[model samples]
Target: MSSAPAFRKFHLMRQRWSQLLFAHWPIDPALLRPYLPARLELDLFEGQAWLGVVPFTMSHIRPLGLPAVPGLNRLHELNVRTYARLDGVPGVWFLSLDATQPLGVWAARTLFHLPYLHARISLTQTGDTLRATAERTHRGAAPATFVASWTPGDVLPPAQPGSLQHFLTERYILYTAGANLQQAVRGTALWRGRLFHAPWALRQAMLTEWDSTLVESHGLPTPTGPPLLYAADALDVWVQELRRI
Candidate 1:
């Protein structure tokens, strides 16, 4: 498999992600195939598919060369996502993205054509443990909520290719679909967004506390058993503009 690709072209935005909790669960491929766009394929690792629910804080977010706005500079976000590939390019395909800030949600939806929803979200840190909560409040959308706490453990060596950790966290591109249009010739054209970031400084994570219905809210079966967990301290990211693929 290919490692993360570099973006030599101009990036449209920049942001910092911190205190991230990567929680994932294995799922049957059949459960997700029905929801994915016709042009995208569900990515798998060793014949198993996975779903992820990640919660974190984003800061210093602004378009390239622009000063970060006061209220929009930072916020909490939670996303329900899975892996996918389009024409041989691996990327993240989000089922839903919930953010505490409205403007951020609007920009993600309008500018990137992703499923961005407004939610009530909060994060607190105490010593080595972090607690996060998110409740989707977007009108006319299915309700989704997540509450969990995690503590970082020993730092792990970088994930080798083909490992589950690498499959779950090494993604750098994102694919999004625009609103469905019955008259459109290509019903499910996909858009690709590229991101540049340093390799993740990952550590084993202990799930100190948890409760969530975020996955089931998407009409998929509730994930059973504990989720695979990993934590990252922080990373600076540059995002490129979305383009048709």
Candidate 2:
């Protein structure tokens, strides 16, 4: 894959993502196929698919040229995602995103057509360790909770094109659908949002603690063994408006 794509035209939102943890596990392609829309294909590495559960803190969220709103500017977010490709462009396909701010959830669902849910979440730092927790509170939605603690380690070199680290962390586009696969096949619109950020400052991470059912809540099996872990300091991002594919 080429380096992270750039989108300098215009952006609708700006935010800082900090103290992030990327935890991923391999899964069978057949199991994840049914969850994706017809217009997008499951992106795989060496014929194997993977699922990721990311927990991070969002700060300085605001519309372009506007100041950050007091209560909406900061929040904790956790997301369950998988890799996808549409017309040869790789992007993230989110199954569910749970955030602490209800307004943020509503805006994401309505404006971006992403599957966003309201949740109770918190993040704390103790010395060199970071702790995160999230519980999905959306009424009638599948119950999910995540609790994890990690310590950042030495910084690593940048991920190369063919590496798994690059595949999982370097994605710059996100694909979402307003309808299910059946509707997509019937000509429903699929949306793709582009994001621009500096190359990830990756670091080795030690997952000191983890107990999560976020993936299983979506009807998939709980991940087995330890996950592939990585951490990053922070990055300022610019998100362009969602476009129809």
Candidate 3:
């Protein structure tokens, strides 16, 4: 819905995202600038910048037209992200992505140039409540940990075109810089990947416990005050090829 993909249909993989919690906090745009590639413009909503800590489950992951491998298809994923734009197109810019699967991390880093790090993570759900935990265990990487629990409440319709919820959750493109990847690889300037998914089935959510070092891991200050929380129902996704942009 960010105006980039037209259901392009030529995807690299198919995956499902479920039991997701989107936790967001407003931040000073200046504080996030140093961490972004110069080529990207930090995207803002009414002159404000936001950072999100998202915990979700990835399952049924497999290459296009291939069957999912039994052991490797499911993973626990958590990411810290901010918004950005490139060539007038808006998208997400990841600060870090921690995953439970080692092979999945390697494939994402090498193929998509994302900042995918290895971590110990788990997720559990019962009725309308979910609990999640994560700790970065990748060798030589900055240590970051998160623990949280929440209950989904009051199903909401898809966000309208101009609403804050739409700005915060409906991103369909993502940008990555090879040099900024976790392992310090160099040379590629910038890359963009487009994805296609249906409108999110959302629910208002309440977080009983919210604590993380994900934002601080990038040397940014811990944001104060309660965060904006939303829970999304499962959506199947189509990830297209990552191309230098």
User: 44-157, model 2: which lDDT tens digit per residue?
Assistant: 999999999999999989886788999989989998999999889999988888899988888887878878888999999999999998888998778998899999999989
**Tens digit of per-residue lDDT, candidate 1, span 182-241:** 211146577889888877889999997888888887789989999999999788888977
Per-candidate TM-scores read 0.93, 0.93, 0.93
TM-score of 2: 0.93
Segments in model 1 whose C-alpha atoms lie over 4 Å from true places: 1-9, 179-186
User: In model 2, what are the clashing residue pairs, if there are any?
Assistant: none
RMSD values, in order shown? 3.7, 3.4, 3.2
lDDT digits (tens) for residues 113-172 of candidate 3: 888999999899878789999999988778999999999988998799778899899999
lDDT of each: 0.85, 0.87, 0.87
- Lowest lDDT 10-mer window, candidate 3? 179-188
Better of 1 and 2 by lDDT: 2
Cα-based lDDT at residue 59, candidate 2: 94
